[model samples]
Target: MAGGGGRSHGLSSSRSGPTSNLLFSCGKVAIVRTVKSGPNVGLKFHGCPLWPVSV
Candidate 1:
C-alpha cells in the first residue's frame, strides 16, 4: 500500500472529460500520465494508484 497513499494530491486538474470517471481496483481515481521513456514513450494512459506494487 506504499504507493497507494501520498500520491492522491495534485491530480484533480488532470482528470477531465470522460476519463474523469475512471477508477482502479484500489478505489482510487486513475490519473492520466504519459510514458517518459522506453519503447512506449509518449504513450498516454490512465495510471493506477497502486502502480509498481500490484493490485
Candidate 2:
C-alpha cells in the first residue's frame, strides 16, 4: 500500500515468474504519483517561466 495526501493506493496480483510481483506493484504506484504531480512541479530548464510566456 502507498499513501499520500490522505489517499491510499493498493494492489493485488497473483503471478510469479521472472518478474517480481512486489517490485512491479510498487513501481506502478510510484509511476501514478509521478505522472499526477509532474505537471504541477517546476521544470529544471534554464530561462523558462514557471508558467508559459507569450509574446
Candidate 3:
C-alpha cells in the first residue's frame, strides 16, 4: 500500500515546466544560471534575481 502523510517527500512535480516561467519567493521571475566555481561548475540551473546579496 502507498504511504500517506502531511510531510512532503520532496518529490512533488512543479506546476511550471521547462518552457514555463518559474518565480522566486520574492516574487521575481527565476533566471537560468550557470555555476562559476566548485565541483558543480558549469552546471546550469535556475536562480533568483536577488541572489548573492549581503545581509
TM-scores of the models, in the order given? 0.50, 0.16, 0.60
In order, the Cα lDDT scores of the candidates are 0.66, 0.35, 0.67
lDDT of 1 by residue, 11-55 (tens): 443356654556665678876789999998998877876777855
List ranges where model 1 is wrong by over 4 Å.
1-20, 50-55
Tell me, by TM-score, which candidate is best.
Answer: 3
Query: Model 3, 1-55: lDDT tens per residue?
Result: 0367675322333577767666665677777799999998998877777778889
What's the true lDDT of residue 18 in model 2? 37
At residue 32, give the lDDT of candidate 3.
77
lDDT of 2 by residue, 1-55 (tens): 4345865334444577534343233344122222224665642321112123365
By summed lDDT, the worst window of 10 consecutive residues in model 3 runs over 5-14
Best by lDDT: 3
> Which pairs of residues clash in candidate 3, taking residues 3 or more apart in a chain or in different chains?
none
